[model samples]
Target: YVENNLAQKTIELFNELKNPADVNKTLLNQMKLDDIQSSIPIYLSAIKAVSQIGDYSKAQSIFKQIPDSLLVENQIRSALIDLWGKVGSVVEAKLIFDKIRQPNIIEYTTMGLF
Candidate 1:
């Protein structure tokens, strides 16, 4: 869905898979290791889709759904920087960028584009 630029569809599918009732449960407690690993790609795709749709609020909402474990991943953080920049929030992007202990090429490239 993301590759095709189907932002809305991507968002819908993500929302459908997540159970709101599980809000209080940490992802680690709710899902297996494999499940979390597999969902990482989908989460990343959804972030990119949110950017394509230019829905800053939705982007933040989806961001809050992500497990803290995943947030530290460079790939996820890089995508977030791109998402924030696309949504007209350079400050948010910079904040995420600054948190990286050792930003990689992809992170630099994404942040540099802003």
Candidate 2:
């Protein structure tokens, strides 16, 4: 759905995966390592969709759904920097970028664009 540029549909499909209320700590605790790892990309896609909509509040909400373990990932933070920047929140993007110990090419490129 995302590849097709259907941002709303992508978000709908993502939301259908599980209830919003289940996206908290209890959900994280129930997921295995494999599940967490695999879901990272899906979460990233959802974030992208939210970014395309330019909804900062929705972006923040979708971001909060990501597992803490995933936040440490460079790709995740990079995507977030892009998302926040797209939604007119450079400050939030910078905050995430500042947390990265070693920014990669993608992160650098993303920050540069903003």
Each prediction's TM-score versus the true structure: 0.67, 0.67
Residue-level lDDT of model 1, residues 1-114, one tens digit each, is: 344455565465446555432221222233333243436676776676677777777777777778788889888999899989999999999999999999999999999999
Q: Cα lDDT of model 1 overall?
A: 0.71
lDDT of 2 by residue, 80-105 (tens): 99999999999999999999998889
Off by over 4 Å in 1: 1-38
> Which candidate number maximizes TM-score?
2
Count of backbone collisions within predicted model 1: 0
* Worst lDDT 10-window in candidate 1: 20-29
Record all residue pairs in model 2 with backbone atoms less than 3 Å apart, i.e. clashing.
none
Q: What is the lDDT of residue 21 in candidate 2?
A: 27
Per-model CA lDDT versus the true structure: 0.71, 0.72
lDDT top scorer: 2
